[model samples]
Target chain A: MGRWRALANAAFALAVLALGGFGLYQVATRRWHVQPTFHVQVKFSTVSGLEAGHRVRLQGMDAGVVEQVVAPGKPGEPVELVMRLDQRLRHLVRSDAIARILAEGMVGARVVEITPGRPDAPLVAEGGAIESEPPVELSDLMKRTGASLQKLDDLTRTAKTGLEEINAIAGSIREGKGSLGKFVGDEAAYQSLMSLTHRGERTLSAMEDNLAALKRTWPLSRYSDSRSFFEREKVLYQPGSRRDSRLFRDEELFEPGRAILTPVGRTRLDEVGRWCKQASQPQSEVVIAAFTNDDHDVDLAEVLTQEQADSVRKYLIEKHGIDSAGWFRSRKVAAVGFGTQVLRQQDPSLAQLPPRRVEIILFTPQT
Target chain B: MIARGVWQLEQFGRFVGFVALTLAVLPRAVVERFGEVLWQFEQVAVKSLPIVLGAGTSVGLVTWLQTHRLLVANGAESALPSFLAVAVVVEIGPVLAGVLVASRMGAGLAAELGSMRLNEEIEARIVLGADPVPSLVAPRAIACALAVPLLTVLIDASALLGALVGEVTAGKLSPLLFWRDSLVFLRLSDVIPATLKTAVFGLLVGLIGCWTGLNADRSTEAVGRAATLGVVRATLAVFAANVILVPCIQLATEALGLGLL
Candidate 1:
């Protein structure tokens, strides 16, 4: 049994040696699959992780494996890879097939995948090469996503901050705290209303005075005697001087020598003065003071007392019945109307002083 | 102290035996003893053609697809040949060949040697005045050395074939144009270094397996251990050789002014 076993071993050894020799012969003669059934080559910019013997696939089906990888002769050119595929697959492939590198998944397992070419193209020959298409890398996608997210975050934050600032401005305006507040609030509007009221009042008063003067001159109806009254006043009063230039012509009456009180004028004034003296009491001098919203003037002319003015008015009403209340109310009193010689003729300096003028003003108040 | 010294001496003896057998191995003598190393070569390298071709073809297809993908990204997918040619010639040919040999032949050789040692045949040869080193060790060593380089060349060729198949299958390139471009840039350096590295790897496989078998204890368990250790050591040595040799070859080539050409 041992001898037989040894013989078997020897036979096996011999067979192995014979086969090995045959294989060697085949290698030398280039007989055993030396020529490729079909060939293809591809190029790449970088093959940093890829190596020869990496598997090649077609739609996830294994087609072949990598044979070789090489750098180009020139700089900045693609590195190349050579591959061989099964002979049976030659008919399916066309000249326009695309080859690409892809990762197995998110982490990575580099693989080369080939897509079949257009059916219209000519059938591929043995030992052919193909062009490669670039695939998107995970790192690139991640970078772009991160940048976009960051931009979105920044935009949202900016919008939020702007909205907050606007809210603050609106709140301040509601509270009426700033310049905008003054425009929006009611106090300034109320103040403007009060100023308008004062202006309206002054306008109305001036219009009323004008209306009163018109009422006296021209009555509204036929029975009214407003025109007759105006005619009576025209006859009773001396004709006031008429001048083309009114302001300059009025100065002539105040000239020293012009219209000096004559004897007839003095006798008429004395008669009026005697009646004024008889009507007025020596102890009880009635004083009429004129007051306005704004006034500091102390003296102008010797003004009549209330009693003297009342006596004159009574005498006119009882004897002549001249109703001149409109004239009285309309006149803006500058000085008291008095007989001219009885006037003290105070110096202009004394008249200008407020104290001395006040003393003189006490004796002749505005009626 | 004496026990430690004796252990050290035994380890040193084993190392020396390994070296001596490696140096003494003869390819022609191994062929005579094992009815020609070609027999083992056929079984180890020839039969491996299908697997090598499959692997190489797959590698080529993958490389073609990847390179094309990248080239398309850069808008330069046309220059596939030169790239593939240089890669196959310089890197993939020898390294993958070594890996294949280690996986297929290296492990088998160690197991066979371990089984022989366990069977007492090795002892019997020693008693009969037959040197096991020349008989068993030399044949396996020489066979591996011869087979590995030869297998590497086939692998390279198969890979190129696979690349062509991929291109044709994809219909992206013409076979004639691919070869023309690939061959245009290929050089002797690409071929020589690959074969040389494969041979070196083969020698490492034989040396590691034989050394482990010869140093194993008399126990059956020791033989098993030796075989497992042998495969492990051989694989590691093959990887180490690749790492060291590639850089050395690159430096030497550069020193000689060899580059892309």
Candidate 2:
């Protein structure tokens, strides 16, 4: 029994060695499968990492291995891949078979994927070449996609410019500029400005339309309101709305003509800040308006108040951390600065260091 | 202390010469004592099969589990099989076969020869006009040098099977898919050399075991020390040889124009 056991052990060891040796022999010969096979050739414009031992698949079935790579002698010449396919599956390879090189599992070994031809098609002759397709390289695809996107972006820019020109032409006709403007004259512009003061309770869309009409008025271009303060003013002046006003003197908010905030101004605005957080709703509109009475130059007054109004708006949004964006609805905040009134008389009424004031107006829709 | 150091150096030189002498006479010894070689093969390859296979399976399963978790996070779960193939076939299998043999067979060789030395059987053989080195040492050394590469091949196969089984449990890839992907990354160039390199490891194990046993003190306790020292020295030699052999093999393959695949 012991002698037999020793024989069994020796036999088992020899078996393992035999199996291992056979596997090594198969691999060294570059013949992965044992099936009798016939050779076919495929030519590719480019083959990335396609070696002699890369797999060959017939309609997604593992058929054989790439036998040899025949490189072209010169540039622009195709690389030829010699493949061996199982003789049993020889009928599947018709003369019109399409061969493509694809990567296995996203980044694995490159394989030659052969799409079998139609059943009616004749079998491809042994050692015959098939129709080859170039691989779709990711970098080339990206380049093509990028070029397409750039073309789309350029088209969109041209479209936007065309619309802007059309818009300017329409405005020119209303405000009386160019040949087309002489027909409608300034009466259309005057009518739009008039409609702004009397626009009644309307839907938000109608409000936008009215604002668009007002924006088309003469001298409206020089207003320079990025926040569309005129649009917010129309929304604020609804009937049955309660307006609460807080006034701070120019000395309280700024240093002379500049818009920079002072410590005293910040301290005073804390009361308004508390009102903003506690008393404000999503529907409420807060408008910061600064009035200046600089005696001689109305332009100086306009510049001072404009800067002050902007400064107050910046502080209100930033210092109090009033979230400008919300999921459901956003806060409607506006800032406008008004210079001193221009009188009809040649000489304007002047005051010496008259107190210029900043007003924070909160307009809530009547509940 | 200086004299002791010089003596130790001379001892090392003798060990080297003994290894060289064993290699020089290996072919003749193997042919003459073919039966002894078969018996040692029965002991080394067949008996050591269970441990090597179990270690291989565990290595594969652990490697699969680890590479899966890591690659899945990087959105490269597709690369698991390729990574597993390269890791196991190219690096893990050879080293593991060496270490496993070192741990198992190293001490067995030491104790077997140690007992003979303690019994003065080696002295008796020398007196009887027979050299124990050819009769005993050469056959065991030949067994290991031949057996280790076979075991390494077994381990590689078992580890790959373990990975396939792991993939089955994971259900991420079918058996056919895992196999296809696994084969896609395996190159004969890497597999052949990596598997064959363990022969050096086996030679080290046999030499160290024999060297320790023959050089042991005459005391009974010296046998135990020899056995323990056999495992430690053989295991260390396997690792050190692997470190040296890898670059040498790389350069050799490159010179042969079989540059690393």
Candidate 3:
């Protein structure tokens, strides 16, 4: 290298290296060519994966990093985080400055986001503690989610049963059974109906055979399966809590039109009586709802169904020895007569399956 | 085949000897011939900087452009600054800077020494009171080892600047926010070891260049061959060094408690 070229190169090299070295020094010290900083402490019940060296923002502006994490000394004590804030921005962090721990993005690191206090609020002293809002507890959220998922699983099971009933009703309509079957008057339409009926029966049988396979098909099946893996009757009819319902045909519960119990009806009520022994409590409730299409007059339909519901309620209290009333209060045994008013719009479930029926439902309080 | 193996073994043995000799004389040569070392440092570091910055800037700009859309789609545009900072600082900047330096300095040093060897200048120096290894080769070797770390730092800065420019112009993030968020994931353990490893790459460039040129055949064609060999070998060495150094440095940081506050 020549002397003059070396001199020029040295000057250039000195300038570049000096600038780069100064920038590096500033970066290493966390002072990005700006003013100095002061310390502030904030205590959080949970940091939500917030670590030392994570960023602390002031009103979403990048301010500083968490300097030290002093873990709680005893049980139930909050984790204390020491942060270094830019001294120039001290006016923004007041006595009422609220610090919250938030995530940067869906999967990014945790950040202590500090929203500034009112302009009139007094500025906190150096090394002062800022007020904090505790982060959402993951365990509590998971517990609530588990409960919600349990309810959702129950709904999914009921929806499955409803859909199966709809399939059966649709098959019945194809075979000239329900109101929808009135369209099939032509011979060609009848042949098409016959073909569709066989296909529906085959599909229904397949659905019945692959019931467990269907449980594994949906998106939330894994979560649902883990939540309630027991038999449907056992899980759905847990003894002293939630609800258990049984449906009996109107003829099975009462004489053809007289609201009187037959031997077969008595035998059926006995099984329910056994279930009530485990499922009933002093505060437990039983509902007997009866429906009938036997009477043409709406008022007469209402009376007949009402009488049938009353008779079942009476038998449960008298024969099964269930509680009714004492002095101040009574164990509620509500008997509602839906009559011939299937009102498919109001109670679509009533319009389908078993046109004349009575339902017994038991509701028990949670332990 | 046996003869070729013997030749290969002989070459390997001589290479090891040269490496040992350079290591032994390095400290003394650096102190004694400080002026020559400074000149060589300027030649290797300053002169090669423009290309390094250009490469660094383009790499960072392209990385940001590619990543920002995906981040925005996922509502993670906020993570772009810190994400780019960690990637460029710890991995991309050092190795790319090392290779750029190697490409320019490796060929230059080899050709310079090879021409001198062809002209019998090294022989003339040896005939005098001066030793060729210390007076000629050592200064270049020391300069290369020192220059790479400095260049790596420059590359890191320029790449961040390039990414910052993209983010500000297109993504609408303030420069201040970008600068602040960029430091969130960076630490001494990551930056120090990553930049320091480039110095090893520089040492390889200088040594291989000098070794190839000095051991070149005494012909005009050999000078060109030496220059080509210098660049190829140095570039490969830098990449290979990175693969080995990363795990070693990671282990060292954990063992030394560099991760703790």
Predicted model with the maximum lDDT:
3
Q: Per-residue lDDT tens digits of candidate 2, residues B86-118?
A: 788889999999999998878998888898999
- TM-score of each model, paired residue for residue: 0.40, 0.62, 0.57
The candidates' DockQ values read 0.02, 0.15, 0.17
Residues B55-109 of candidate 3 have per-residue lDDT tens digits of 8899889889999999999888988988899899899999998899888878888
Off by over 4 Å in 2: A18-33, A117-123, A170-367, B1-12, B71-86, B111-121, B170-184, B187-193, B216-229, B243-261
Q: How would you encode candidate 1's per-residue C-alpha lDDT over A1-367 as one tens digit per residue?
A: 2456446645644654564355344332221134344677878776646665555786676566666787789999998987766565677677788888876543355778889888899876665667688667667789999999999999999999999999999999888889877667768776887899999999999999887676534234222333443442232122232111001111121222232333443344344444334433222222212111112221222122222233333443444323322333221111212211122344465344322110101122223
List ranges where model 3 is wrong by over 4 Å.
A1-4, A25-46, A58-61, A70-80, A87-100, A114-134, A137-139, A151-367, B1-13, B164-171, B174-184, B254-261
Which CAPRI quality tier does the interface of model 1 achieve?
incorrect
- After best superposition, candidate 1 residue A270: deviation in angstroms? 99
DockQ head-to-head 2 vs 3, winner: 3
Candidate 3, residue B86: lDDT: 89
lDDT score, residue A248, model 3? 92
B-chain TM-score for every candidate: 0.85, 0.97, 0.96
Superposition error at A270 for model 2 (Å): 90
| lDDT of every predicted structure (CA atoms) | 0.60, 0.81, 0.81
TM-score of chain A of 3: 0.40
lDDT per residue for candidate 3 within A250-327, as digits (tens), equals 888778877999989999998987787666577787777787775557667767887898988889888985554334
Error of 3 at A348 (Å): 71
Better of 1 and 2 by lDDT: 2
